[model samples]
Target: MSFAALGLVPPPTFCKKRGIEGFRSHLSLCGVVVGDLVSTSVPRPPGPVPSMTPASRRGLISWAELDFRAYVFGAIRNERNEFTDAFIKQLRLRPDKFVVVSRSETDAGQWLELFGGDQDETFYQMRSRMFEAPMASFNNRPVGHGAWDNIRMGRDVLYSTGQAGEMDITGYLRKLETERNEGWLFWLKKDRFKVKYLLILDAQPNRSGIQLIQDVAWAAMCAAGYVRGAYSIQKYVKATDALLQAKITERLSWLPPSYALTFPVSNHHNALLKARYARYQA
Candidate 1:
């Protein structure tokens, strides 16, 4: 039913409850990080509010003023190539245009650097000056061919950017050419399932972005492997198999599947799953 149809009115305050759950997630997407000290425009509709865009109630404070340590910390594992090579590169070119650097020679083991920190006050003052918002971090590059291409990565190659070429396309096309020259994909029964999968968290519900920030940080921690073995509930439950069902439900229902952080939703979970996967293991 329409909110207005029922004569519902909004609160005096505005910009507090615009989006449903993706608010903090959007901040992460925008690359705002821990301790960056920025403000969020959480709009609270005056009356029966209508839909709004992200820019509607541009926050009085800019999140750029806050710290970004935790988000960078969460990126450690993905940067180390533990998650997926593609993911490592994709992060470099995120839309938020966050700046990252590799502290060591190992893969993408770099931390984030916000450009606004130096002039945080200015960033907040210029909130309305969207067009000229100076970046507050390093590597102020744009997305290009691969992963880090968009962001300002020192490297400028497709491989480093996480981009692909005709060969990649050709390989995908060739996968369709069956041995019989048929235009269908064919795989052994064993190949139908993945050997393993990684669950990563994105945005979350509730909070003034603090809770979401912490949750995202924790998820990133798992993604970065700082909280090693956290990706697998089985590993933790091996010591004691209590509250297994509840844990699984809470995790799945909490976030979107696309951003659903998982604990190795293994086929070995319960008796039914075990029975179905037992023969395959043997």
Candidate 2:
């Protein structure tokens, strides 16, 4: 069955139980308690809409995290109108899972407590609760600004590998690459590693943001905690429909690398991984 058939929309229970008051209340409490610990930038942009540099249609998703520190931009749509089916079919989706995290730069201790409480739906519910208002605010802010559907807050710095300081996973370390590089050209090349990502929901503004998306997606697929399903691609009306796939693919080609973290991964991620590693190409 298709993901849509499975009712992939947000659970209605979340809507009924967590009212505006509840989300805002928690935001207030978290904001107040963590205010001294963390800081958010003003909600508006710095100036008028400057001319956008035509970024290569590639290099959107990061293999590692969601922050997208190396590249900075907002995607307007996921499907492009100009591309044809034959031209688009040559590309394969990248294979990689993003790491999702929910850390407060200000309250590391509490953030740890929230995410460390066993790997389960509670983790997502907690994060969804934490990010709900901010997410609503961020998503809605786009409406007022224009017909567009996005907004920018403060920009995040791409910290050096060593700069991640304590959160460093040593094995994943490249230790020296401090500034996040323009990843698309490097990642989407004919012969380089390929992985899509999902960012964390907090909008860490790092590649980890993509990782966060992937992490949460995996969590969602858990029919039961005991049944940790792998990522999978299905014959959806979208993917299977050539015209639709081409339109959607061309447009979303610019999605932040972490955007892939939200894709219908499963077997596809495994294949992409195998292909990139040269073990048994997907």
Candidate 3:
């Protein structure tokens, strides 16, 4: 039903404004559009809001503003030759743009200190800016459980940035491919609309030398091995087991599968294996 038909009028405070335009600007600041105000009786609930366009937000962090230490930490990993090469070139091109945060300085305080605070504030309210997500602290345990431990910690650290509208496309994509197929829906059912910025965390330490390098060279070798065609099932089982061990598939429903920020491309396989599988299907 129309709000006018329901016997409602603009609030007296709204009428107090100079004109409709002033009231509309105030409504927009409160997450409401002037047109929406007329069509709907209910008001939008108050909460955090997006303040920038996708392009403008993305522009804020050029390669130069990226943390250098984490880049080095990630670049040394297997299969990361491309990233390492790119980062090294950027570092040489503009060393002044780099932000250095050491291992001991990974805490919330260090981040605030390095990034600075607001005009009237003495500190960068890290907690105030933190984005809360469900999977942030999913599998908490001591750090001795190998790759799983690393993933758990990584998820937790990344969750803290959700308030900034960081979207994890890779995680969301994986959910569509794997988990949702098995009835694990409703992962990002609520916050999907609120997501504005992509979540691309700097490489963390738990994954430095663990992932195998599977570039074109490795794909060629695998293809040659698969041509022999013996024990193909056994090899497939082993690969599956390794993937399970890595605990590297997208577990977070909020993430999409496009970005490879924290983990290697989980769906990659050697060319030989692909050919053998296709032939077996035939």
Candidate topping TM-score: 1
What is candidate 1's lDDT per residue for 1-282, written digit by digit as tens? 011111133311221333212222222222222212222334231111111223234432121211112111222222324444433344333423222332222324322222212222211111111111222333442211211112211122111322363222222112323364343222221233321111111111112433334334334334433343332323322311222333344435656755434444322223332344455457
Candidate 3 per-residue lDDT over residues 72-136, each given as its tens digit:
11111112344334433332332232222211112333222122112332211111121222221
- Score each candidate by Cα lDDT: 0.27, 0.24, 0.26
Structural similarity to truth (TM-score) of each candidate: 0.20, 0.18, 0.15
Which sequence of candidate numbers ranks them by lDDT, best first? 1, 3, 2
C-alpha displacement of 77 in model 3, angstroms?
A: 11
Write the number of the candidate with greater lDDT, choosing between 1 and 3: 1
- lDDT of each residue in 1-282, candidate 2, tens digit only: 122111233322312322221221111211111001111222343222222343234532111111121111111112223321211121111112211222222343322312222233121211110011111232233111222212221111112132364234321113112234235212222223221211122323223223332333233223112122354333111122332233235445677756633445223333333344464223
